[model samples]
Target: MSRLIRGVGAVLLAGAVLGGCATHPNSEQALQQAGGDFQKVKEDANVLRFAPKDVIRAGESLARADRLSTYWGSGADVEHYAYLSRRYSAIAREHTEQGLNAERGARLELERQRLQLALRESKLSSVQQQGKWLEEQITSLATQTDRGLVMTLGDVLFDTGDAELKNSANRTVLKIVQFLQLNPKRVVRIEGYADNTGGEQENLRLSRDRAQSVADVLVDLGIDEKRIQVEGYGDQYPVEANASERGRAQNRRVEIVFSDAKGQLGAAR
Candidate 1:
């Protein structure tokens, strides 16, 4: 009976030792896995830059797990600490990625704001330049009318009894070109008039021909043809009486009328 009791005691001791040996390898594997995870977290640039505190905590936990495993042998304490280290490492990596994404979003928003501001400044500069050019054109044209800025090219612009434009009239035409180029949205109406001295049919034909000549010149100068409207009003809407040579010259003229934003013009007096 004493021998059997001793034999049972020996078997129980061997079983206890084998269980400890198995636990030891599992604890070692957990610790190694934790260390590898922490190593990966440390190598990330975002983690280094943004999560230094979390990284330090993870490293300390892994070190504690290693020390406990070495001194106390594989146990619950070692496994708990290893798990904590891995969890902390994942947290650090996640926080680092979030921080990097936030920084990138902020930079993109700032860039968008800068581009918008630049575009506004450019538009302002363009508006000021257009205003300056328009003012100069209005002054040089020497037009005084209630019909939204009318410019008159006298009979001298065309040869006697002919629709052809004279070379000397190029200066006046170029001024119109400059104005049109600056204000692309602006539209104009060209009205040609003749004196009462000519026959009604002949005067109407000559008037239309002269107006078409002016429109062609503007189109040649890069102005859109669609923006220009032409008409012939024989011996009509004359600015001066056709009783004398000076008055007749003024009556036989082509008047260009600028319109409002909607291309609507006021009646010419």
Candidate 2:
């Protein structure tokens, strides 16, 4: 009975030792197979940089699974597998995070660009169709040299104390831009003017600033900068005297001057 018990005990010990030894000896190979091997993974990593949405997810999965298998061994294969799995996991994670961030950023940027493009297109269409008077002035720059047409500061463009064009003015500017685009041979002169309420120097500065403001708006709207000549006329050329606030308000404006063969034609600043 004692010998029989000892024999059974020895068999059980052997089985346990065999079981321990039997662990997937080739876990490295297993990992390689599961993870698509290192060379395959390197290629996958390279493609992940610019790969479309579907490919990135697939590679990440394969690399992750293979790496875990490599982690399970006790021999050199074990450390090697473990290293492979760890390294692959890190790379996979890094690629995923970077890719996600970049994708999100690109999506947001694309949406913004689309909105901007639409706004520009809308402004161009609406303004060009409606502003017949404005279009004529801008389009006939070279031919209508001496015909002086005056539009008050409050009537055509710009806002109070701001260089930026209001949406309404932007619409007008957009119309002018399209007109100029159609008539590339034409040239425009932008003049800035200010009321006599301020000192002469200040008035000149303000006038010039306002004129440049108009030119800037037009430029941003797609008109060529070289086609526009900017000038500032202080209170010296005001249509209204500096006696009343209303008169002063009328004087604070930009004029777009057109040089016809004969002389000045339309004033739109």
**Candidate of highest lDDT:** 1
Tens digits of lDDT, candidate 1, 173-207 = 88788777766677889888888777999999888
Model 1, C-alpha of 185: deviation from truth (Å): 5.8
Best by TM-score: 1
Identify the runs in model 2 with alpha carbons over 4 angstroms from their true place. 1-164, 259-269
- lDDT against true structure, model 1: 0.81
On a 0 to 100 scale, what is the lDDT of residue 172 in model 1?
81
For candidate 2, give the lDDT.
0.60
Candidate 2 lDDT by residue in tens digits, 83-178: 554456456656667777898999999999999999999998876665556656555432323444332334334443444545666655665677
Model 1 poorest ten-residue lDDT run: 14-23
In TM-score terms, candidate 2 sits at 0.42
Q: How many clashing pairs per prediction, in order?
A: 0, 8
